[model samples]
Target: MSPARVGRVIRRCVALLLVLGLAGCGDAAAAQTGTVTVFAAASLTESFTTLGRQFEEAHPGNRVVFNFGGSSALATQINEGAPADVFAAAAPANMATVTGAAAPVTFVRNQLVIAVTDGNPKRVTGLAGLTAPGLKVALCAESVPCGAAAATALAAAGVSLTPVTLEQDVKAALAKVRFGEVDAALVYRTDAEASAADVDGIEFPESAKAINDYPIVLLKDAANPGGGQMFIDYVLSADGVRVLTEAGFQAP
Candidate 1:
């Protein structure tokens, strides 16, 4: 082979190697961008979404994904080997279901309230009013935190009002009233406030007996442990507290 032709072939091979190395570096950088998955209670929808945006803004390359539903169901999913970086439950009982979580921190507290459609068409004054003939009411199923709280509150008030429908989560119960499917529903105060445009929260005295503590923790099998811890820390931060207060959640 001629010397000039051999030299040209060597140059082409070196250039190809350099390009492949740069491509591998780009792939590695892309892999470093983390995605943190958070499983939270349905009542945290508004507050957590706002916090998620703030978290993304604070950490440029990290993304926050949320799975909002009943706390009990979320815990069950986590225990069943669902991939989750963080777990924020509406009640301790649900959080207890998941083993090997970092020490849970109470972030906020919530209480049940009677959620009625705007203008209170039924003029429902209190729990007793829910018992009025033909007044359709929606309640969370007993399996959920909100439902358990509602049951405790009702029992404390010595009021047993049968609901027309049993929802799986507070959001679902609140939606029933928001959509005019039911005259009223029992949901967290934060949930009612989040949907204030479509529903009105009626604070009842019995709610004091059923306040729920919201606990957040990093999961043992977290894919993005650093991001999860950052998010939990953010929730306990001053700005996060401000957001929770704005959403009508009481400080823990």
Candidate 2:
């Protein structure tokens, strides 16, 4: 072949290879993007939603779908084979219920607080104040983490009183106070902070004894294991911690 012809042939081959290489790169990028369904505790709604947005922003083409509810209920769903990539529970006890999940890591801690109507109109002093005559109080069901924490705090405080209602989750309990259905509710400090416009979170000393540790793990049978692990990594990253801490979660 003439030298000019040989040079032209080489250029054509190089261009073809470049195109193939670009196509290969596109395929790999596509594989890395998908929706990661995360089943998380109700208390994590605000912070986890924020983290999910940040995660999606950092990983374009990827998505995060969250199912936020009571931790115990979430664990039951996971144990029953609900399709989920990640599980973040409000308590280790709930995390322990999952049969097939990566080793759990405590990501954050939350303490209980009395969520009262705005302006402290009830003059509720502390946990003991809930015992006053006709004082209605809402508490999380004992089966849920918030409820268990409330039980622990009440026990530690040595105060005994029946709540007007036992809600399924912290948010529901907080809602009781927000709607004025109850005089107060024992809820996570973060939940109260999230609803600051409607209620005031009253911190008490006994809450120290009942702080709940938040745990996260990737499900072993996750449909998108890689995406699951990536979301877990982001939750433990500095940026994730910043978001959680700013929202009243304590680093674990």
Candidate 3:
């Protein structure tokens, strides 16, 4: 071993160590200041995405992201250890499945509406209208908020129908009407309103008994509490309720 050769080998080892250290630091920083992912109900897609943008703007240091699906599915993901900062569910029962009975503010309430094609080819007007024989109807699957509410509304009206299909979520249920695949679908009034340009929504009296409340919360695994809590607060604020109300959700 010559002294010059030994020095060159030592220099290369030092350079490699420095590169590895820098890479680790970059990875750690990325993990520390990451986007806050929210597992949310499908019905909240429009409103939550709208608020997600506001949250990012309000907290420039953090980014807000959403994973929207059925409330039950969202709960399953959270319970299954998905990295989530918050969970917003269409029903408290669904939220409780993952978050437990911890106090959660009811952010909004949604009523069932009959979503029909833009021209309403079937002229479906109310809950009773669904009783018409041979009329195809689309309702959210039993596991979804809108579907549960629809069932309640139907029970309240003493009317029943053989639905063409049960969709996975409110969004899919609404699509049946917009695509003209079914004559009508039961969905949250807000969902129908969100697609007003494409579908017609029929309000009915029985919806009162079937209103489902939406609850939002900051999850236990939140990476960005600053942005997460702020987003939850905003959804419960007057302005947020106004947006929900305008979109056909009731104030909780």
Task: State each model's CA lDDT, in order.
Answer: 0.93, 0.94, 0.82
lDDT for residue 127 in candidate 2, whole number 0-100 = 96
Clashes of each: 0, 0, 0
Winner by TM-score between candidate 3 and candidate 1: 1
TM-score of each: 0.87, 0.89, 0.83
Worst 10 residues of 1 by lDDT: 26-35
Score candidate 1 by TM-score against the native: 0.87
Off by over 4 Å in 3: 1-34, 99-101
Task: Tell me the deviation in Å of residue 172 in model 3.
Answer: 0.3
* 8-58: candidate 1 lDDT, tens digit per residue: 999999999999999999877545558989999999999999999998887
Per-residue CA lDDT of model 3 for 1-252, tens digit only, reads 999999999999999999999999987654444477888888888887887777666556667788999998888878888888788899988888885424677888888888888888888878888879889898887787778888898999999788989888999999888888888898888888999999988889999998898888887667666556777877777767776777777877
lDDT of 2 by residue, 93-132 (tens): 9999899888999999999999999998989979999999
The number of the candidate with the highest TM-score is 2
Best candidate, lDDT: 2
Candidate 2 colliding pairs: none
